[model samples]
Target: MKLLMFIKELTMLIKSLRGLCLCLESGSGDKLSNCTKQHIQKLLKANMMGPYGSEWAVEEKVKRREMVAPQARYIFVYWNANEMMDNAFTPLLGFLHFRFTLEEEIPVLYLYELQLDSSVQGKGLGKFLMQLVELIAQENRMGAVVLTVQKSNSLAMKFYISKLRYVVSSISPSRVDPLVGVEKNYEILCKTFDHEAKAILEVYSVQYRTARRVGFMAAFSDLKFED
Candidate 1:
């Protein structure tokens, strides 16, 4: 079956560009309009290595491919038409992969990955793409938008937490059992759209904070990190 394509255009100030002009294209795995899976894979491999070192990157790449390849319908590809390289049709600035699912029985949009080229990292593209995702969720009547972030990636954590107003999910693995989950490297984060979803999600965040406090006290009661 041929997948439907949705193209959205917006104006933004890019460091390398003269004026506001960006395009977001959405398509399924079978019908990528102007790019290929290889292109997306290359972008992912290039941008997803800061937090996760090269040791398990190959394995992780495979896992990511498996997740996104099957559900490309939710992939949002960001293109910069003016920065094309030799023989390339469009400059692949970044992409967002997500899907709709039930989180705590609440229908939500789960963002799998949002990656941008190093050249385009700090130019507001990230926030623009994220806002677009929330718009997508709201249009579909989803209760919330969710994503996971690596704890070690302080830049990303700050972006999501401070700029995007996302909070660590109450039911995130680490929050659920901090003592045992203390070794986890990632945290699930979310942004809810409605009063009902906000109330439901806030309960989890409060519970998690309480649990984390207890865990922190217990963890430091016997041991300490030496400087």
Candidate 2:
């Protein structure tokens, strides 16, 4: 979808959030300033470096430039001056970077990053942002809200699953084939809105289960007979 169309569909979404202490503004990646991009990088590094571990260096390079891609859409969050204790200026609190695209042939709002400053962690701001993303996906007729979470980030995994009700997508590597999935460090998570999306994204197909069973049996057969 074109950027203009994407903005037109959800312009009111951000406007409706004015009552929130944390103001939200929509912007395309192409329009972000170098300063703003640097801010995003810093926030991401703070939140992700630990979870990413040795892979962080490589992933950081990808995210640093990916945030400014023309097709990327962002919801920039800012704290109101009154909410700040030290400074009178409103500071950037966080951002949600996403794209409208197809996943497994289904149109989806794929969230690439949801990074928040350390000060705002655990406050429900993250959940609020996710809710907004879901609303935007629905408003645009997208099938689901999809995101990737590192398996090492247990807190993030729990937040998305326990708090938000996101499921391990059937297309997720682990769900598709546990044997092979053991090598993967991340999982694709999703919240589906309709039956079609639920079936395609959330339901574990028979084939996947069969693969798991076959792999388990094969492993058993290879074990030395001790009896």
Candidate 3:
């Protein structure tokens, strides 16, 4: 996607904020500077390590690889310098890593990460960013906005489900087969835009025994994107 197009639309949406001054920039992961990449890595680890726990060692490696993959696209958020109380305060507020990809033969926007600085949490920025993503998905003709959330991260779960109204995808382990879902640690969530998307992503009716083997393997396969 073109950065100019994103900035133009984002400028209009950001006007809804009461008093915050923000700037949005877009780039591919390979184009980010080392300093910026390090900051993102640190922020991601800080927000996710706890939920990942023993799986972090392996997950971190996967995340690191995914972070700089050529397909990875980023939207970097910065506090407008003029809005800062202290000139020395870091302008980098947060970032969203995502990709325009295919899921189950449907084009979709897959959100890989959304990390915000603690100082900015509870503000409306996170929701605003998600709204922006949904708009982008629509503009790109995507069927839905999909993401993976750790079930253990209650706050994240609440934010996506309760606040954003994203539902557990039909292919998610829990819905496909609760017995097999017990072995998984995360849920795939989605907000579909069309009837086809809703049907594919929000409806499920498979036998438990059959789902235990087929659904379990399909749901957990590396063929799908991860958080």
Candidate 4:
């Protein structure tokens, strides 16, 4: 429970920092768009907007979507060290998943990657993190959580459906959801945020970790804008 408490604090911190940073950068500066825009602009500032676009361009789009993702409003979750866990705690990419928030009033979690430090696999830590997602979403009043899985990955599919009670709903275009994985799916599941979602995601740590590593993130929501 100590770890859970730390997670809650961290989530609050992430929300605050992201909101603050956006406030500072929102609606200001010259209009640059798309990841490719910034790239081409360095070569020639004018045509780049119509053509290759810039790094800020792509980032802007991804940022906007975080709030207006057609079918869902998303919030990312991450974790960091806590009272119980020591600084030596193992982490993968400082967090997990690069999915989206379903664009809905109630919201749904669409998890992408499940990258864990190889040291923790098969130990149910993934399940724990997932449950953590559910808990955070519920805490934030989300409806359900959804994720896509590879059709070939029976092992993973089984883990989710059997262990987590997720059911296969639909397969994608024989290709993976760009954010999810190699398999095709639109499988959905529901967890009782009030019941099982007792934990919170450490979004603060998640955001900091992301910012520290990538220096650019449009993950939680899309950051695109029009000129």
Candidate 5:
């Protein structure tokens, strides 16, 4: 309810200011009066709120969404309606959600909200995002980059597995989709980062499952080593 009020307030404020600006520009006063300037400032504040509020909303949402954690930075293909130096963004589809975040010891490039407008699907932007993911992962000293693909999406599954060296880490094996009346299996892909971390997240996952759960949680609670 509060958010709704804020949106309404901002919308009304923007509408009023735009009208005021048009009125002033047409009048004898070629320069903005104090009141007009203040009104313009309010418009500016509303414009600025959009960006900051979007960020805060994302931060708040990340808490509830099933997402990899510690995503402190978010870079985009289209940050604003305008990027630096007035360079018009490439027309290949917008915001691939090709965003990633480096977790404590791993980095995962999530396919956030990918859509190529059905026109640019065949283009190589998807490949470019994967390549960027690998570069960023290595730079961050993270283990392996992980991602998931649906069994029905055979083409995408193949793209990750064959091109990016991602291997299937887990499978649902039983999600026979009700609509399709066919089987649906989710494949979890993990490209063994440098071979060792790959072995750890995989081997550790398996070993941890069989592991005694009694005192294990406490042992990893802190990694600090002290005699």
Candidate 6:
């Protein structure tokens, strides 16, 4: 049953990519050769510099090597809106860098990065990439999909929370200790695929679960209800 769902997800991703005029090439482990690594680094650097600044990505040159690590997986999305002419190339649209890892001892997919060009932003490409990420997570039997977002990046927050239905992870540093940790200016968010993952990662605190519950309660504190 799971196998069937997995196959279906793969098929769905393929169809969706074609429909979007994009191509998906996924590779695992050492398949990410030096040339591939260079390509990814270049794309990431270009996409990240605007949001994070040049100083922040100085480390990315070194960190990008993780994509080639054992068990790591890379999904590169390419733009095929224009056909290659006389050996010309189609540009890269975006990519997903993720890997299987243990979260609370349960298998999960940790999304290192999901990047799309500015030209494609808000055109449903980001959501399409995330859909493939979720499908890949489920197909791999992962319990959840996890990623980090900068607090200053409200656009990303809204995209993940309101659009993708992800929530701030209970295990996030800020959630665990909001005082000092909040100064970190980032959040760890996740979307679980199973009950166990939900239990582990989802925040069930009254304040977090409810929509502005504390504010509502305070505003209506003087109201009395007749039983």
Task: Give the winner by TM-score.
Answer: 3
Between prediction 2 and prediction 5, which has the larger lDDT? 2
Model 6 lDDT vs. the true structure? 0.77
| Ranking of candidates on lDDT, top first | 3, 2, 6, 1, 5, 4
Judge candidate 3 against the unseen true structure and give its global Cα lDDT, from 0 to 1: 0.87
Q: Output the worst ten-in-a-row residue range by lDDT, candidate 6.
A: 81-90
Model 2 quality (TM-score): 0.80
Candidate 1's C-alpha runs over 4 A off are 1-20, 30-35, 58-64, 74-90, 205-227
TM-score of each: 0.73, 0.80, 0.84, 0.39, 0.46, 0.77
Task: Give one digit per residue, the lDDT tens place, for model 5 in 51-91.
Answer: 33535455334422322223322222322243334545332
* Runs in model 4 lying further than 4 Å from the true structure: 1-94, 98-100, 103-106, 170-227
Model 5, which residues run further than 4 Å from truth? 1-92, 98-114, 170-184, 202-208, 212-227
Which 10 consecutive positions of candidate 2 have the poorest summed lDDT?
A: 9-18
Q: Write the per-residue lDDT of candidate 2 for residues 1-227, one digit (tens) a residue.
A: 56566576456554545355666789999999888988898898889999999999999999977888999999998986567688744367899999999976799999999998877777767877887798789878899999999999999999999999999999899988889899999999999998888888899596865786798899999999767
Error of 1 at 48 (Å): 1.5
RMSD of each: 11.0, 9.6, 7.1, 17.7, 17.6, 10.9
In model 6, what lDDT does residue 56 have?
Answer: 59
Error of 6 at 175 (Å): 0.7
Per residue, candidate 6 scores C-alpha lDDT tens digits across 17-49 of: 434666678887587767667767777777666
- Error at 35, model 5, angstroms: 29
Q: List the residue pairs that clash in candidate 6.
A: none
Q: Please state the error at residue 105 of candidate 2 in Å.
A: 1.0
